[model samples]
Target: MTLKSFALAAAMGLLASTAWAETKIGMITTLSGGGAGLGIDVRDGFMLAIAQSGRDDIEVVIEDDQRKPDIAVQLTDKMIQSEKVDILTGIIWSNLAMAVVPAATAQGKFYLSPNAGPSALAGRGCHENYFNVAWQNDNLHEAAGAYANTVGHANSFILAPNYPAGKDALTGYKRFYEGELAGELYTELGQTDYAAEIAQIRASGADSVFFFLPGGMGISFLKQYADSGVDLPVIGPAFSFDQGILQAVGPAALGVVNTSQWNKDLDNPTNAAFVESFAAEYGRLPSLYASQGFDTANLLLSALEVADVSDADAFRDALRAANFDSTRGDFEFGPNHHPVQDIYAREVVQEGDVFTNRLIGVALTDRADAYAADCKM
Candidate 1:
């Protein structure tokens, strides 16, 4: 072949390779240990979103931090430096989110939070570079708190682990609950036994109980709560009674009320499609964790369409605009860098072969977060 022809052919090959290359999105989560179920859901949901969008050029590099803060930070740093990832996402725990988000943002990569909205990040710690597709730590609990007031549950008991996220959950509930608090209990983080706490709750004789315990802790509480035979109604945030825990708790969790931003039975066109596709792909119903993950992918894709997102500042600005079709219907970022969305009160129901949650009512919709005023971002 002629030298000019050879050069032209080589250029064509390079162009084809570049065109076929995918946009790499670094996803770090607690893939193993206790939080594995939630991580699996997030991964599956992100993939489902990508499939539905029909965007072949996007890719996700998933890493499991095992719910460890140090591992999370290391994985995030590697993703930013070695992988040269275009975007960063995942993280299930508030501590992990706190550990990694700053580094990811300081490096000027867009950090999309699929879960974990710590109060610190919701207030003055908010950064333009960080965007949370999930509600703030308090939003869901606040909805429950409002529901408590509406239901005439004048006296209530609150329980949570002694952590920043746990504290935020209770504070969120208090934002809307004007009634008298029967009792408040804060246990050590990751404590399994709730026998002593259950005794206290029974003694308190509150009309309703609120709690925040995700993963194994949630399972332990649900099983114990059922065994305790507490006559009063049970209410709390959704994470503790999530799909992951439902399998463990069995029918013990039935009739439980929880507040959340998303449920498997939303019945919206977008959510229905997402749920159907996710269940088919993962062989299980999608939880709120998965819903947030799907929304995060959608959010990133929307920003990518608006602008190239080749640089950090441009991507951050685009994300701040919150231009995406969130599964929750109304998708917008509040000043606190958390989602301004509806919170639903849902009941755990046994749906045919699987246990899933159905919405009881919309407790709050398009509500501004309590801490939004404190967030200058």
Candidate 2:
């Protein structure tokens, strides 16, 4: 070939490489320890959405936080300084979120929360570039409290772990429940044995019980509570009653009503497709965490379509628009960049030895976070 032709081909190749640089997304999630299931679902769902979008101009970097706050902090720094990721997402626990989110967003990088929506980030600590695709920490707990009232739970006993989300849970339950509190307890985080807690509940003289334990904590609590023969009707947020947790809890989770923003049985074209596709791809039903991850990816994809990430103002405004069709049906961002969406009451039922949740009813309609009013943004 002539020298001129070869030079032209080389010039074209360099131009192609220089243009359309793939957008980098860093995901710091719990993938190899307690609560790994939650983070795994989030990662799979996010990847599923990205795959279906068929977009070649995006790249994702994933790291396991190992359910440690320090690990999450380190991952955040590595993502920002070394990986040069433009966006960050996929954190499961509130304490880890607290350790990672503030510093990441403060650096002018966008952080989209697929889970772990702490109250501080929703209210006085709100940021322009931070978006919570999942419900606020209080959203489902508040719905559980509201549903508890309608079901004639005039006096209730509530408990949660001693973390940020746990504190948010009890506070949210009290905010909406008109009932007198029979008792309230905060267990140590990741406490496996709930014997003492159950003993207290058994003696508390409560008509009903509500808890906000997630991951293995919930499985242990439910099994022990069932064995203790506390026949009082129990209610909780969907964290404890997720598909994987329910299976581990076995019959202990049956008939327990939990509140959530999405369920496999929600009636909508979008949700129907998600459920069908997720089951086909993963060979299992999608849980609340999975749905949130799918939505988070789609939300980011939509914003990327309309505005470049380098233009922070335009991208932030696009995210505030919340242009994705969520599995929960309608979804939009409130002033605080948290979701303003409906919460549903779901009941656990067994189908051929497999445990899953079905939508019983809408617990709260168009529920906005209690902290939204406090957010100046």
Candidate-wise lDDT, in order: 0.85, 0.92
lDDT comparing candidate 1 with the true structure: 0.85
Residue 201's lDDT within candidate 1 is: 91
TM for every model, in the order presented, reads: 0.92, 0.94
lDDT of 1 by residue, 1-377 (tens): 99999999999999767744657889998788977988888888887888888887887889999999999988988888888787888888889999988778777777888888888887878877788888788888899999998889999999899988888888989999988889999988889999999999999978888888877888888888888888678888899778877878888788888998998778678888888888888887788889988998888888877766676667677888978777887788887678888899999999886677889999998976776788775
Model 2: worst 10 consecutive residues (lDDT sum): 14-23
Q: Which regions of candidate 2 fall more than 4 Å away from where they truly are? A: 1-20
Model 1 stretches with alpha carbons more than 4 Å out: 1-22, 311-314
Report the number of the highest-lDDT candidate.
2
Clashes of 1: 0
lDDT accuracy of residue 197 in candidate 2: 91
